[model samples]
Target: MSAPLLLILIAALAFLATHVLYEWLAKRLLIVSGAEYLVLGVLLGPQVTGLFPPSAVAAFEPILVLGIGWMGISAGTSLRLPRLVRIPSVTYRLSLVESLTTFALVAAGATSALAYGFQASYAAVMLPALTLGAIAVASTPAGLDVAFGLSARAGARRAAPVLRQIEVAHGMDAFVSIFAFGILIAAAHTQVPLMMRALTTTEWVVVTLGIGVVGGALFHLFLGSERSPDRLFISLGGAVILTSGAASYLQLSPTLAAFVMGIVLANSLRQPAPVDDVLRSGERPLYYVLLMLAGAAWAPGSNVVWWLVIMHYVVLRTIAKLWGTGIVTWINRAQAEVGLDWGRALMGQGRLTFALALDYSRRGLPYGDLIFTCAAVSVLFTEFFAARFVRSAVDPLLVPLEQLSMTLSATTEAVMESVTETMAQRFPALRKVDPDAKEHEHKGKR
Candidate 1:
């Protein structure tokens, strides 16, 4: 077999192994970190073991693109209008405030690092910063999923509210980052005249939306009245793959296009439930592959300036999340208490961040390697610390299930007693029979 094919087989096995390990660890520890898989990937990657070389990784780019496009679709479906309406206004406000603040702060920090710190050219500084900022706005869903899972197991009274905020925040951030990245990509085409460039970007966006609407409609029609899981998976998967390929061929944003398609499908009144199930079923394995490839592609420089840039990106991003969430909550008395735990809860970054970085790198953005490495390092940091923070923030709010059980038991017993007393008062013969009458009668019969 060819070396690239061999590498692909190894990666698939590794991905499966990681999934099993994650499940086992999650069950035992109540928290399973994805950082371990990344570390494993690094160990087996070109920079270390030289098992999966640059050539091998390059060969896998198409697969990565498909995975990323699917991710965008998954995220798009998350923005179901009905669900969004059900979310609290505070959750929406927090998501927007925190995401935008993170974007602005990261962009500023990156631009400064490039221009003043590293002394790069004007175009380099602006373009890299814009892409970096767009990428930094995302938070991984893994940490939130684990936190909420544990909270539910512990019967946390406040879990519902926290879960809602995190869900809304994560979902909104995904859309924001993808959309911003698309716009940035469009804006980066400077070969044409200013007027033509603006028109071109607008046209790309419109075309992207059009692709989504038409693709989604087609998907719905193809599924027809069938509810078979196999059929749903095949049809939806085929549509997404076609969409991804078309976007790549057109040099447009596959992520944005897939996202738009997802939105269309999700909002369609006649959309089948199996469609969602199919997407979710395929998302996990694809996510694992995406992250592993991201790790394999990791290459860091020895420059102090780059290190400084990474640190600046990390620190400023944190401050942005806190500051944004703080100001929003402080201004709104209703969410004041929630803001206290918001920033820490949102610190986790994972697959989506890596995917965005990978996308940026594939686009040949300036300083793309540095951005990817920084993102990888930052994701590791957040994964470690964020889990602890989520636990800490949620632990205090937990209402143990034992307490709930006891309360329920007491209420049930009281209700039974009240019913028995009412029956006894209404039926004098019943009261005369007494609680032991049946026992006495059985003894006599024996």
Candidate 2:
């Protein structure tokens, strides 16, 4: 009956609706262009909606933070210990190298823009660069999902070395982005002595590893004797969400913690793990809200924002893509039999970029608006090329399957033709080759 109660109910529905809409739209647009959906969020957010008013948005902030934590914890759980130990040097090397490359390129552009008479302040220039750098550290799972799905549709088994390496690179990016943001946030606010102390790169990494170990260990002990069909995933999901939420509250990086959790669970847990279903359940909801929040808050149409967007999103992102892929070419040569031509498969900017931009905005970085604009643009452009590159890279693998299907179809047609011909030649005689006739012939010979 009260206006306050009515508003609360409406906001609840809005949150729920946003998630469902995001998932539905993601499926549809991913087929069209995944990057488009990123902007769609900006369209729905306050700058567009006038729906997510300051008060409404501020109220939702806590929930958004919680969602972020959930995402991080979930991500941490992806880092399997076995996978890490199995390829230690390559994993760490690729991640560090790529993160730095992306950071430098994006930062240089932002710095240049500032020098060229842009309105960005000193903090804005440095902060945006760091934010973009953090984004650069993220890999687009949506792009990967699209690529992998197309590969499967085309009947590919295990992905080629290039694709595999890209996936690993993405994982590394996610790991680095998490901690990088933590350090960035801490550094930006020198007054927060505690934040600075806790977020030293080393401390950030240790905390991440610690969270994973502790979370995974606790989950294992809790679920060791469980026999339910979905025990592995349910238990793991609970731990990830809890760990991520708790870490966020503590001002730690939930993304790193979640990633570490994922890694530990995959290695330490048994086969037929339940993580797939659990992850699926959480992913749709979290991603939907995340994008909407980013979109609703997006500020478009300013010339300064436009200029910044072009510099960072278009030029810098392009450089990063080319450079990142080129690095992959070398890494692939050193470690595997697969060769990746940077010209073909390097369009990978997705949710990770959005997340980093959001992280910076949340921290009051002056370049938040610019970062959002750039990230939204990058997602769009990358999605367009990602589908093409993925299809090209995966096409070769599908050719044999295509050939096999055609061969089988042709053989069947031939067999049917032969059967028809034989029937036409001896329809009546077919009945005459009888059991009694063979017996009679044998008796006569005897």
Candidate 3:
């Protein structure tokens, strides 16, 4: 194999090794210290250790887009209308209020800071802030996943309701963020005239949705009465890859287009099981690769202004999450307790934020580096603390029950073993006739 291919192979192997270590010894590390993998990418990347050259990284662009497209589809699955209808109305109300509040506050603050505080030009101020706002709206699913695990272990009765609310809120916020970012990206093109530009954003959205729906239909048709797992994987992957390529060609959001395709498959078809299975199986590896690439490309300069912008962005976004959640909880008294603590759940940032930041950097937007760096830093802080806080909050509720469950499990196992031993001693003839008699009898008894 050639040198570039060799480097790519090495990176893949490294990812596998790191993933194993992460899974076996440090599952929380995967969620909290995700940026460390990115740092590894940087070390192996062109700018640092030069294991992978810039040209090689550029060549891997298709894979990056594919990773992003997969993330979008995963996000899309959460927004199925049927699922949304089942969610509580209060969940919907709280999700909308909290997401919109964050978006509005971040946009307003970033725009003002960039435009007046930094004396940035028109595009520089408005575009970056708008993009940041969209990114700011995303809360990591990892936090909720961890929370669910804790709730399950603890058997907290109230945990399910809160988890459901967070899930809906995070899903809705991601959907809105992708849509808003698509429009912002369309509007960023200064070459287009005002009249045409007004139509451009709509046109892109239409084109994206159109591609997604068409792709979904094709996938559905291909998978008809097919049960082979390989075929299902290939078909779903092909549709997403094609849709992502088309979106990229049109300067639209591949993630959004793929998301639309997922939504289409989820809502428009009868048998979405195959598609869902394929997506779940592939999401993790793609997500890890995407983060590593983001780290490789990250190059935040040590400018005081940029640092200040990042700090302000984080502070304002946090305030928005807390304040908005508080207000919504106050209004909806039924779920007031859930609403109050919901903001803590929203602290983590994950795939969507990194995906958007990578897209911004790829687009070469003004102050893009600053925005991307801020996002990276934000993810590190939020993912680390959010996971800890959610675990701490929910674990306490579960400790007593968990201990009781463990004690009961231990007692039952010991009693069974003792009974088996007693039976073996009582019927030595049975053990002689069938050496495994006690084990088999124990299994039967259980």
Clash number by candidate, in order: 0, 24, 1
- Candidate 3: where are CA atoms >4 Å away? 1-7, 14-19, 25-33, 122-124, 149-159, 190-199, 335-339, 393-446
- The ten-residue window of minimal lDDT in model 2 covers 335-344
| Candidate 1 lDDT trough over 10 residues, lowest sum | 189-198
Task: Report per-prediction Cα RMSD to one decimal.
Answer: 3.8, 6.7, 7.5
Error of 1 at 274 (Å): 2.5
TM-score ranking, high to low:
1, 3, 2
lDDT of 1 by residue, 194-228 (tens): 44444567777777778777887888776656688
- TM-score (C-alpha) between model 3 and the true structure: 0.81
lDDT, residue 111, model 2? 67
Candidate 3, residues 188-241: lDDT per residue as tens digits? Answer: 643435454445666757877888778777876777556778987777778888
Stretches of candidate 2 off by over 4 Å are 1-45, 81-99, 115-124, 150-156, 189-209, 224-238, 327-344, 396-446
Comparing candidate 1 with candidate 3, which one achieves the higher TM-score?
A: 1
Ranking by lDDT: 1, 3, 2
For residues 1-446, what per-residue lDDT tens digits would candidate 2 score against the true structure?
A: 23355346545645565456544643565442334544555554556655555555556665566556555655555566665666546545655676677767776776667646565566547766666767765665555565455344422443454455555666766777777776665455433355535345465456656875788678767775565647655665567667766555555556656666666666766752455446655654555566665666666556764675466556775666666656754854543333344323445566556666665666566656667677776766665566566556545644555588899999999999888778868886654467889999999999
